[model samples]
Target: MKKAKTISLNVGIALALFAVFLVPAASATTVSIGSTIVGEGETGVVSLMVNDVTDLGGVHVNLTYDASVVNVTALTNSDFDSKPNLYKRGHGWVLLEGGQYESGLSGSVKLCDVTLEAVGKAGESSYLNLTDIDIETFTYPPTDIPIDEVINGTFTIKPVTPSAKVVINEFEQNPPGDDSGNEWIELYNNDSTSVNIGGWKLINSGGKVVTIPDDTVIAVHGYWVANWTNGSLEDSNEYITLYNATGTEIDNTLTAADGNNDERCWARYPNGIDTDSDNDWKYQTSTMGETNGVPVAPVDTTPPTTNVTAPPTLWPGKPDETTIPSGTPLPWTSEPVQLWFFRTDNSDSGTGVAYTNLSLASESVADLVNVTISNNTWTWETNLSKGKNTTVPGTVGEYFNVTISEECNATIEYYSVDKNETPRVEPKKNLTVRIRFEIPFSEVTPGTRYTANVTHDLIEPANEGKDATIVFFAETATIDSKPYYVLDINKSVGGTEMYVGINETAENFTMKRLVMKNKTGKIMDLTFNPEYTMLNYPLWVGKTWTSTINVSGTVTYANNTTIPINIITTEIEAKVTGEENLTTPYGELRCLVVETNAGILDTGLSKPITITAKYWISADEKAMIPKYQSYINGNLTEELVLK
Candidate 1:
C-alpha cells in the first residue's frame, strides 16, 4: 500500500506522491531553506536544512527565486562541503547534488547553502522558493527510501539609506542619423547623495516593459544615461513609466507626439527640469548627458515656383488708334503712341478711336493700355526702371485695374460642317450582312424538326463568327411543353426572307433530320422533305457507319414559279478515325475526329455534288456537338472550316 503525504501550507510545498509514494506521513522529511533579512546591496546566505529524518545517503536540491529583486549570486555546500557534490547557477535557479554517502546522513543535516544579494529597491521582499528535492536516506544506504516535503523561504530587503533626487532628464526618441548607439535615456541626479536604480521597469505605451539591470546608478549632481535593454524608444507617440522593485509607480512621461522632430528631441531647458508639459519641453538639439541648448532646425532647402505671362498687342480694325492716358515719362518714351480703344466701335462712338481724347479716360498718349481678359488681363505703363530688364520697369498712377491672373486660359470655339449629315460614319446601306444562328442545339424542343445554320463561324481563321445551315428533329416534348432539341437560322441583316423547310429539332440525341429550301419564298410541304441524317452514335474511335438521305423537295424561284418535286437519295459514309486535343475560345476539349463522305448516290440527281469533311465532335456526353468542321469545295480550290 502507498502512503499519503501531508503538504505544509506555510512552506508552500506540493508534490504528487504517485505509485512510488511516501512510506508514511509520520516519516515525511521536512526539508527547508530558512528565511532571513538583509540590507539593500548586502549579500546573505540561506542554509538548506532537513528535519524528522533518521538517515540520508544522497540529496538533490532545486531552488528558485526572483532574479530581479534578489539575485542568487552564488551557492555552496559549506555544511555538506566534505561530501562529493556539484552545483550550478541560472536566471533564478540553483541546483545542488551529492551522492554515495555509504554511512548515510541523519536528521538535521544541512544539504546546501545558497548566497543571495539584495540588489533591488529598498523595502521589497523576495521569495527563495524550494521548488523540488529528492533524497535517498537510510542507515544501510537503501535506494528505496525518499524524502517527501520541502519548505521555501523569503528575503526581506530592509531600507538602508534615503534615495537620491534623480529625474529622467532627456530622452532621444527620434535620434539623428544612425540610432545604433544613440537611442538613450539620461537620468539626472540633483541631490548630493548617490542612488542605485536597480530592478527598475521602463515601460512604454505599448505595455512593453524592460528592466534596468542591477547596480545601475547615478552619482551626486551627475547623470546616468543608458541605452534601452529591450527596444529603442519609438518615433511615434510614446508614454513611458518607471517602477521600482515593489511595483511602485515612480515616475512617468505622458504620451507625447514624438515623430515630427527633424533629427532633434524633446528636452527641458534646465537639464533636469522634469515638469510634464508641452511648455516644459521643446524640440531641441539633442544633448547626451549634458546641458541642453535652444532648438535650431536645419535650413529650409525647398525651392519656389514662378509663373509669368505676356500677351500680344491688340490693334484697332477700322481706324488709326492713338493713346490718351498719361503717366510719368520714363524709358521708352520715344515710342509711337497707341490708344486703348475701350469704347464701342460703331454703336456708341462715331470715330473708331482717337488717343488724344483724355475725356474718354485715356488722358495722354504715353500711358495707353487695353487688357484682353478672356480669362487673363495685363496692363502696360512706363514710369521708371529699377533694373534693365522686362520685369523691373516701374509704373505709377492711372493704371489699368486688371484682376485676372497670368495663368488663366482662353478656349476658342470652332465648328466644322458635316460633309455627310449622318449620326455616325456608317454606310448609307448595310455594309455587311450577318446570317445568325437563331437557336442553339441545347434550346431545341422535343417531338419537332428544325433547320438552321449550325456553323456560326464559316470565315477564314475559322474561329471567327459566320454562318452555316443545320436541321433538327425533336423526338418528343421534354420540358415545359417544349421539344428536346432545336435549330434555327435567322439572317442578321438585309435578307428579305428565307424559306423554311424543317424548322424544329431532333427527337432525341441519337437521331436527326434536316431539310433545306432552295431559295427565299420557296414552299416546302411535308412531301417536299430534304432528308438529312446527322450522326451515328454508340461510337468510339474507329467506329464507322453509312447512312442514306432520301429528300424530295420542290424548286422555287423569285418570280413565284415552282417545279414538280423529285425524290433524290444521298448516301454518306462516316468513320470515327481518331481522337485529338483541341483548344477553342471556350476552353480545351478532347474531341473525336470523324471523316465523312456524302454525295448523290445511285438513285440520286444527274449532277451530283460530293463533299468530304472532317468533323471534330466534343467528347463530353452533355455537349455532343461538333466544335469544328473542315472540308474542301467541289472544285477543291478553296478550303472551308466552321467553328
Candidate 2:
C-alpha cells in the first residue's frame, strides 16, 4: 500500500495537538488570489500563504501558472530575473525562499512580475497558480487567466488633404470648377453627424438662388455637394453663393469668381459659426477637401438628370423636313447608340438575320450599353477578343450574356439571349440577332475531341426599352481526329541490299506505304552510312529500352554479308537496358513458323523478320535513343544482331 504524501500549506499548521480553547466552532475559511501592478521594464512580487489550518498532513500540493498569460518584459536591473525554475514545476508552481517559520505563524512566498519595455507577441495570455496540488478534498481556484485582455488603449485615423480651405465668401457657382460652361462646388463634412442641407439655397451675385431640398444630407466625415443642383449643373460654369434656410449668406466664393483657391467654407446656420474648417480638420496635417490646391474628390452627391432634345443635322429622307425623334445618330460607331429596324410582318416566325459588325480583336461591346428587343426573349452582343479566348459554361442550349466593347471609343454593348439552335441571316427583312460562341473545351490538345459552338438568335429591340435577341446554337462540322503513323527505314550492306516492308496507316482506316531514307540523302537505298537516324526515332520507353528498329540505313552482318531493308513493319520497341548506353530490341517481329507454314524469310510475309546487329543500325539511331535502338511509328525500324 502507498502512503499519502503530506502537503506543506502552512509550516506551523497542525491538527490541534493540545486542543486550544474549545476548538473554535469549525467555521468555513475562504482564500483569495490577487495580482500586482508592474511598470514598464519592472518586476512584480507575489506571495502565497495559508492561515487558520487545523490539519495539513497526508496531502500532496502543487501550484501551476501559465507564463504566457502574463507579460514578461526585460528587467531594467540584472538583479530582477524570472527563472521558471524558481516558481514553475511540473504542471504547477511553488513558492521559493521560505524564511524562518514560527509556530502558528503566517507563511509567505515572494514572486517578481516582469516589466515589459516593448510590446511582446500579440494574442497570448499568461497565468499564475493558486491551485491545490495534492489535496483533492481541499478545493483550490484555477490560475490561468486571460493576460492579452489586460492591455492598454490605442487610437487611429484616416488620411486628409492639403489646400482644402474653410472660409466665408461670395460664390458665383455652388462648386468651384472650370468656368468655361462647366461649374461645380465641393462641400466637406468634417463632423461625425449626417448634416441636413435641406432648404439651403445657393445664392449668386445676381440675386438668383437655388434651393437644396431636405434630401440634401451629407454623410458624416465625408465630402458632399460636389456640384450644385445635385451635381447636374456641375459642367455649367456659373458663380455661386451659399445661403442657409433663413436666407442668410453662410458661405460664398470671392468677388473674382475664379472658382479657385481656399475661399470656400461651410457653416451650420446662415452666417453662423463654422464648426469645422478645411484648415482645421483633426488628425491630419492637411485638409480633406484639397490636395496641393487641386480638388481631391467630388462629394458623394447625387444630382437629378435632365433630358435635352437636339435636332438632327442630316437624314436619309426628310431633308429640310422634320422626322420622328425616335431614330438615333447614324453610324453608331463605338457609342451605345440605339439600333431599331422595324418591318410590318405578320408571320409568327421572325426573319433570320446575320450581321458582322466587329471582329475577334474588337473590345467588349456590351460594357456600358444594353439592348432590348420586343417579342424576343434574349439579347446578345459579340465582343470576343482572340487574346482572351474566354469560354462560357453550360450546354450550347443555355442562356448567356453577349457583350461587345470598343476600346478606341469608350463604349460597351451587351445583350442576353438563349441559343438552342443555329441562327441564319436571311434575305431582306427586319430581324433582331444575337450571337455568342460557346466552346466546350478550355484548351485544345493534339488528339482531344473539342466542340466550338456558335449560338444565334433573332428578336425585336424597340418594345421594352431594352435590347433583346433570340439565341440559336450550332457546332462545328468536325471534332478531333487521331494522328497518322508511318514508319520509314532504309539500310544497305556492302553491295547487297534488302528493303523492309513500309506501312502507313491512319486512324480513319486508311493505309499507305511508309517512305524510306538513307545517309547519302538518297530517297531509295544508297551507301550504308550511320548517324542519320538518331533521336528522330523512338527507341526508348521511359528509362528502359524496348526492341524497335528502323530500316532507314544499311546494316553490316558477320561474314561481310549485308541486307538492305527499306521498311521494317514490325511491332517492336528499342529500350535502354542499363546505364551503359546499350539499346536492346525486344518483341516479336515475325509470324510463328507454324502460322507462316513456310519460313521466317517468307517474301510475302505481313510480319517482318527480327534482325539484331550493332553495325546494321543507322548512324542517327545511336544518338536518337541514348540507350537503345530506334522505334518509330510504334514499329521497329532498326535492330543490331550480335556477331
Candidate 3:
C-alpha cells in the first residue's frame, strides 16, 4: 500500500484549555524495611497499591525491597484507564526460567485467588522468588529505560516447581505503518536469583536460525522481551520458535496456523495485552497454579491513577479599519466569520481609525479548522443581523460603527492566523513598461509554454481616472488587442511554412518590421529588432509571409501611450536518434538520450531522451510517442507539454 501523504502546515495554535501540571510529591515507603529476611519456603504475598482519589486516571507506586530475601509472586491487571478499582483476580504468571516461553500454550489456570507467596521459614538464609511480574518492567536490574506510564495492569507469582517454567506476554498487531511489523515477547524470572539469557537463540517456523544479542538478561523480579527492528526477518503470517543457549527449543509461537490473526502464544502471566486466545495470548481467567493436584489461583491487588489540569487564557487584540475601494462589494468578511464594514474616522478629527472595530462574539469564532465552512456568515440569525438600515450620521466625523456580534460561539469555532498587516502603498501613474520575452520555453527543450493569470485593482485605478493602455506582447506586434507570435515552424503538406495561430499586442506608437537570419541563409527569418518609424509613418497590418519570418514592430492606440516592442529569438538543440521503445501510453517509435553537462542537469544516472512521431489524424488513428522530460532525484522537474 502507498504511504499516506504527510502534509506539514507550520501553523501554531494557542491552546486555551487543558494544562499539564507536575507537582513534587513526598516520597512514600512501599515496603517496611528490615522486616524481610532471606530464604526459600518463606511464602508471603506483599502487595502495594497507590490510590489518588482526586485523580480517577490513576497513579503509580514505587516499591523497594531486598531482592535477596523476598520473592515477587505476581502483579494483577497493570494497565490504566479512567476508572479506579483493585482486582483480586488475575489471569497469568511469570516464573524463573532458562529461556523465553511460547504464548499459545493452553494448559490453563484460573486467576481469582492469585496471591504472592514466599514458602520458606523466617531466620533461614532463604532466597525470594520474584514470580509472575511484568517481563518488561524497569524496576528490574539495569533499570534505566523509561516504562510506558500510559499502560496499567497487575502482576502475581507462584512457588517454583521442578516442572517447566514459562512466562508469556503478547503484543497486538497494528497495521499500515509502525502499527505492523511491531511485536513483543515477555519472559519472567520467577526465581530469587536473576537469570541471564546471554546466549539464547530465537528461531522461526521455517526452521531458519535467528540471532539474539548476548547482553540480554531477565532480572529476578522482572521480564524480558523481543522487539523486531526494521531489518529483522519476520514472518508476515508465520510462527516464531524460541530456543535456549543449548539449542533446546523452549517456546514457539505458531503463526498462519489457526487462520489469520490467531494466537501463537503460551502464558505464565495472566491478564496480558490480549484476552482472546487467537487474537491475544492472555492467561486463563480461572485457575492460576498447579500444586500437587491442587489449583492455586493468584490475583494482583494494586491500583494506580493520573492527574490532569486546564490550559492558559488568551487576550484579544485591538481592531483596525480601512476604506473599501469603490466598486468593490462593501462590508467584507474576515474569513469564516466576522463581517467587516467601513466607517468614517471618528478618532483624530476625521482622519479615521486605521481599521474598524468589530468585537466579534466568542460564539462566532472557532479555534480549529473544520469541514462546515462557507462565506464568513456566523449563522443564519447573525447573517440577518446585517443589512439593517444605516443611520445617517448628524456629524461629519461620526462613523457607522457597524455593530458586529455573533449568535453562536465564534472564537471557539472560526479560529484564524493573526498576521500583522503592513501599511498599504499608494498607486503610481503615467509609467509605461513594455515587457518582452527574456527567454522562451522552446530554448529549454523539455519545457513548455508559460501561462499566468493577472488581476488588477480596478477600483483604485478607476478612482484616479488614469486613462492607460495595457497590452500583452508575444514576439509579434499588434493593434489594440494583445500581440501574437508563431513559435513552432514546420514544413506543411501544401509546401509552405507553418506559423502559430495565437496573436499578442504591443506598446509603442510607431510601426516597423523585423528581419530573419540563419548561418545557412537557405531561408530568411526574423530579427529581434525592427527599423523604428514615427507614429505618422505608414502602418502595415494583415500581412502574411510564406517563408522563414521574424516579427517585430511598433503599435499605436487612442490613448497615445507608447513603448518600444522587440522580437524575441532563440535556438534549441534536439538531436533525436534511435528506435522508440514500446510503452502503455506511446507505442513503438524512434528516440535518443543526449547527455548534457551544461547546467544543473543530473548526470548521476542515465536520463531519458524520449521522442515520438505525432500524427494529427483526420479520420484514422494517430501515432503518438513519448517525449523527453527532465527529472531530479525521483521527481519530475520539467517536461514537454505538447499543445
Candidate 4:
C-alpha cells in the first residue's frame, strides 16, 4: 500500500509540472516615437505612442536629435489625465515622464505630444533617437513592464513656398468727393510671421510715388492703409504698384478705368487673394480697413454727352471764319493747334464722366492729273503767187516769192496746171529753204514767218487761165513751245471742266502743264520739271521702257496752312506684252497691251505706295490713247473704259 501511494504522488507531481509548461508567456508592449514632416520656420507636433499595451500606469521616454535641425518647444500629455514633466537639454535632447494616479492606460495610447520647431534649412533631416524608454503596470509600487520595441523617428525639414506673402488688397481711386484727399490704397501681409515693409514704395499710374516710413512692421495677416495725403490718385485710368525695400516688384494691381460711379471702389473680392489679373478684383463700396462688401450694379448706365471746339477756319486768301463744315479738310500745319472738349453727365445726380476718349485719324488724297486727246485734224491749203516776187497772188509769171506762216511743220507741193510739163526751181534758193527747215519741229516758235522763192516755166498764152498751184500740208501744231499732234477739245477732271494738252514727238509723249479752275474761281497750276512720259511710241510686242517723275509744289489748305509737297514716283518696269482688239465707243480698234509697275513716295505720307497699272493703248492716233485702263493699289482695284 505504501509503494502505490508513492507512485500516485510522483504521477501527480509530474502532471502538475507538465501543465505549468503548456501555458504561454505574456507579450511585451511597444513604445515608439512618431515621425513627422515640418516646414522651415514652422512648428510641428510629435507623439510618444504606446502600442499593444495593457494596464499601463507610468511612462518615461528620452529622445535625442541633431541640434542644428530642430528644437523642442513644449511638451503636453495626450492620453494621461495629468500633464507630463518635460526636461529639455539644450536643443539636442529631451526627456518626458508621465503617470496616471487612477486606472492605468490600455493598448494603443499616446503618452504625450512633443512640440518641435524646424530651425534648419530645407532638405535637412534630424533623427529622433529613442535612447531610453520605460513603462510600468498599474500596481501599488509601479511594477516595471518589459518594453521589447523602441521605434525611432525622424524630422524632415522642408521648404515653405508661398505664392506671395504681401499683396495689394484694395484701393479707392474714385471717391464721393475730391479725389485729391479721398483716395486710399491698402496692403496686406499673408505670411505666418510679422513682416517689415520699411523703405517700400507705392506708385500710381500718374507718376506719383510714395515711400513707406522707416521701422514699419506689419503683423501676420495684417493690413496697412495709405491715405491720399501721401500721394495723389487719378479718378480714372489708374493703377498702383508695390515694391520691396530692394526695389523688387512684389505686387501690382490691374489698370482700373472709369467705373463711371464715384461711390464704388476697386478691391480684391476675397481679401488678400492674388491671381495677378483683373478677374481677381471687384468694384464695390469703400471697405477701408475692413472686409470688402458684395459687388453692386452701377447706378448710371448712359454715357456722358460731349461737345468739341475746333480751331478757327481760315482758308488761304480768304477771310477767317468761326466754324468749318464737317468733312472739310484740315490742314497739317507747323504750329500746334488746340481743341477743347466738354463732357456732362445725362443726369445731374448720376455718376459724372470720369474721362473722355479722343481718337484722331488722318486721310489724304493725292493730286491726280490726266491728259487725253479730243481731236486730231490734218489741214491742207492751196495758194498761188505769180509774176513779181511779192507776198500776194497775181497773174502767171516765171519767178514768185511767197510768205508761208504755220504753227507746225508744213510741206509745200507746187505743180504746173498743165500735166505735160515738169516744174523746176533755182538750186541756190532751194538749198537756202531746205537749210532753214532743219530746225527741230518742237523748237519752231509759233507765229513765225518764212519767205519761200519759187521758179516755174512760163505758162503758154492758151493756158493763161491756168495758174501754178501751190499746196501746203500741216501735220501738227505748236502751243507754248510744245508740239501737239492732237488738241484738247472737251476736257474735264472729277466732272469739272478743265484743259489738259498733250505734247509729243515721234519717240514719246509727255505732259507739260495742267490748269484747273475751281468753283470759287481759284486757279491751280501744276508744271512738271522733267515732263512725265506717258508712252514710248512705236508700240510693238515685247517692248519695254522706264521713266521717273517728281512732283514738287505747295498746296494751301482750308485752314490757311500751306504745306510743301514733294512726291517721287519711280517706275520699276513698263512693258508692252502683246496686242489685242477691243470694242470701244469710238470703234473696234487694235490695241497694244501695256503693263507698268511703279512706287510712289510722298513726304506727307507715312509709307510708300505701289501701283500696278494695265492699259490697252491705241497706237494708230499717235496720241497713245487707252481704250481700257486699270489701276491697282494694294488690295483696291479700279477700272476705266472709254465712253
Question: What local lDDT does model 2 show for residue 484?
Answer: 31
Error of 1 at 257 (Å): 22
1-643 per-residue lDDT for model 2 (tens digits) = 1222234423235544445655666443223234554433334544333323322221222233333234333212211122222332221123222211122112121222223221212333233433322211212231221111111111111122323332332122323444433344445544456667778777555565557777687666445543343333321333456677777765654333232333343222222124444332211122223431323442322211111121233233544323224213232222232333222111234221111111122343322323322113323332333222222211111222232232222222211111112332112111112222111111112222211111111111122122211111111111123223222221231111221111222111111122223332323232111111111122211222222233333332323334555543232222222222233342222110000000123243334444331222122211221111223223343332211
Model 3 vs. true fold: TM: 0.18
Q: Model 4 over residues 507-538: C-alpha lDDT tens digits?
A: 55554443322233223233444555545655
* Candidate 2 residue runs with Cα over 4 Å from true position: 1-160, 167-202, 208-239, 242-498, 503-643
Winning model by TM-score: 4
Give the residue spans of candidate 4 off by over 4 A: 1-165, 191-199, 230-232, 258-263, 291-643
TM-score of each: 0.23, 0.18, 0.18, 0.23
The digit string of per-residue lDDT tens for model 3 on 172-247 reads 2222234334444445454466766778766555555545678776665456666544333343565566677887
Better of 3 and 4 by TM-score: 4
User: lDDT, candidate 2, residue 62?
Assistant: 29
Rank all candidate structures by their lDDT, best first, as comma-separated numbers: 4, 1, 2, 3
Displacement of residue 299 (Cα, Å) in model 1 is 55
Show how many residue pairs clash in every candidate, following the order shown.
Answer: 36, 117, 113, 0
After superposition, candidate 1 runs with Cα above 4 Å error = 1-28, 74-77, 81-86, 138-141, 144-148, 160-643
The alpha-carbon RMSD values of the candidates against the true structure, listed in the order shown, are 37.7, 29.9, 34.5, 43.5
Q: How far off is residue 608 in model 4, in Å?
A: 99
